[model samples]
Target: MGFFSHTEKLPGNWPSRFHHKCTSKKCTYPNSPQAAEGRYVCLGKVNGSPCKGTYEVSPSDAKAAAGWISREVEREAEQSKKLMAHLQEARRRKDDEHLQLYQNELATYKRVLQADAEGDIRFIRQYIRDIDSVALFEPERWHTHLIHLREEVLRLQRLVRELQLKTMNT
Candidate 1:
């Protein structure tokens, strides 16, 4: 599998910056001051143990970043799902030809997303093209939307966690 490298975005004094040794679980790293020069110790292993990694942030900072990315991904997934639902409904209404064309376009867009080293936000909007082509029509059920949204949100959260870990080590 291909790996996603985040070296460019990560800071140098990682592990220690976000997580410190759990000397007292009750008193978390809240009282700890911000890192300087990317120097943070790794609390995951031994106390005051220096680690090497990049993309480090304070615990709170990491939380904020994760939340931001999660929200964005969730929104994207929900939009994609809405488009898919529209295509489905259109097909049911004897618009199979148009809907099939959208499916093809969606597949191509997914490929573009995978291949691009840096994602083009402009093309992201084209997902709307897929829906518009089919004259998008779908029952906007809150539960279904939430279900799809959760998938992308969790995936983005994982990515945030991985980036945090990376910062801690470098």
Candidate 2:
């Protein structure tokens, strides 16, 4: 597994796959006279594959490879986070035209979702107000529709925020 830095070794089981016998005389695993029979645990990649231990890497090479992988993972994480923040800000912006479109869509959604006689007259009034400029809509009624539209838009925005928060937490 890759990480942004040298991960703390987990305690109680500093384990590794069986590697080759150590060549260094100071190395305990290979100090036996029959060094070829000695066992080892791999701590690095080999033969262009991972977790299939069959090669021994120089300590220097393993450290370098680990560092490279760590930096790459960190870079990717930073980029992904920046992109998500931008998308979230764009989603939250309140543009009237976009809000109107969402209002129309919400009306349709309400009709499909609500299974009762409360078919939402508020939707029809708002829809008419948007399309008809000459129609003399009651001022109080029109104002109430605008207020309801704002409330509905806010509710949808909150739902989107909740979904985003849930995804990020996971």
Candidate 3:
């Protein structure tokens, strides 16, 4: 058994800044670069001996990485406010089905907002990277794409509800 025995290996060759510290005992190295085959190799020395220990690369400065996530949260909160208004309209119209759907979607939005606030560095970084790539490739269609995605989700939800109702009846 080892320190990383229960842990899965980390993928990719991330930069030194992304890595926090080495996990080897008594070897407080700052970063561990990936080997040729993608194993993290510690570059620390312990009492005149090469540490050469293998450890998972913990993320450095999660708060720093969460800056984009904070801005995204603000944007998502505004979107959720619109969703809340829609939910209110459904209530006013006494649309039970739509109200249920809106409640479910609002729950999902709250869960996502909670996750964003918790600041998962890897997820935040990947999300920012993906959004940046989309904006770069399809500058004009970015907002339209988001709108289409929301519509698609609503359509899918309705379809799923219809199927569930049919199944219950059958």
Candidate 4:
């Protein structure tokens, strides 16, 4: 009520006790000739003390108080709504940023794992080729060389499959 900026106006309708008076109390006027002749004093007490405020019963004063109070209430409500909307948007933006960062980290980890697996496969193929070349010159060791090569190839294939599955799961 104190924050409201009052303005002058003409007479208007008598809307009941929605506006605050001094100490939350309202004004009163007696049914007498003096009431029609003079201004009405607000009976509301301020800070536990009597209020000295007075206003005429004319339409101008009533309309002015009502209009000022209405505008202040509307302005405050709009400001509150805007503040809540801003907070919600900020939270949504932060959540999106965190999600993007997590996705980037996951992608980087998968790429490193894929590179390691490819390197392992490359080394296994080269080792198998080296053994085959030696076996061609030593015919007595051909069977043993093939068995060892097959075991190593099987192990490397299983390792590659496991790496693929790991990346897929995460």
Candidate 5:
């Protein structure tokens, strides 16, 4: 888990500044002679954890830094692939669950609407029977109440029909 530390390039393979600490707090000299001698610093973690460990390498020692960088890149790539696959599986499972929930809700709605429509029909039938009885035995008793009852029956019938239409469309 190593990477090349960001450094400003100076002339002849020298870095402008070293991430290493200096003894003097107000030291103006950033590029020490030892640090400037083709040294490449790895400002990366020692393991997966952020240790901030710095590994210094000379230009002549390419094998050390190259091996660390290559291995880290390979490991990260494999980890990313596994994570991507896991995410895709989770998304697919969630989608299936959501679809099942939607279907269950639709079925519940249909059952409720059908029950309501049947109840309305029963009420309309009872009202018709009452109206027939009144017309036959007490025609003089017919008033605004009878008209309102008739309108209510018609309204119930319309409501049931609308429910039926909605069910069919869905």
Candidate 6:
């Protein structure tokens, strides 16, 4: 039986595949290892050929992977908090366009958080890639953009008020 064939019986809802960098010299293939003979072995292909790289599995290696996953979840949670703040500001300003954008972003973040909490590594990874592909994961950029929009809205409001006053005097 192959290593991945028995992955459904593994404990802790671990992912069926764990990605590890190929250690082969001058080989740049991205390696994904599955358990074999009590250790993880690379099963990746290079240029349509099988890769021969191997990685030894250790307790510390498992711990490091878990830690990395936890850190990603935490970072996403922090970004969600920032998104909530932006959503509230959008509501206060009655800015429907930004309000809708923030709402959609928060919904996506919620799904990512839920998948991470349920230990669905595959879903989380895919979702993250989808987000990264669109370059929408930067909370700092969103914050700056919101500030600029707010300034423009205020400037336009001031212009309208000035026009109203001029018409009243004429």
- The clash count for each model shown is 14, 1, 0, 1, 0, 0
| lDDT value, candidate 2, whole model | 0.47
**Top of the candidates by TM-score:** 5
lDDT per residue as tens, model 2, 1-170: 11112443322333322223333322222111111322335334334433333234445445655565567679999999999998866665534345556557666545523422355566555555565544335666545655665677568766655655654554
State in Å the error of residue 77, model 3: 60
Which residue pairs clash in candidate 3? Answer: none
For each candidate, give its TM-score against the true structure: 0.24, 0.30, 0.24, 0.36, 0.39, 0.34
Candidate 3 Cα outliers beyond 4 Å, as residue runs:
1-132, 136-139
| lDDT, residue 37, model 5 | 26
Q: Please, what are the lDDT tens digits per residue for candidate 1 over residues 1-170?
A: 00113432223443323333233332223223333323344333225543232223445555654565567679999999999998866645544444445455445544544433365545533543444423223334423433554565455555545545554453
| lDDT for 50 (candidate 2) | 35
lDDT of 5 by residue, 1-170 (tens): 11224452333443422223222223222322231224333333434543333344354334554554567679999999999999877866665565455455455444434444576555444544654655434545434544554565555555555555554454
Clashing pairs in 5: none
What's the lDDT of the predicted structure labeled candidate 4?
0.49
RMSD of each: 25.8, 15.0, 25.6, 17.1, 15.9, 26.8
Which residue ranges in model 2 land beyond 4 Å of their true spot?
A: 1-53, 94-170
- What's the distance in Å from true for residue 22, model 3? 94
Clash pairs, model 4 backbone: 11-59
Task: After the best TM-score superposition of candidate 5, give how far the Cα of residue 70 lies from its true spot, in angstroms.
Answer: 1.5
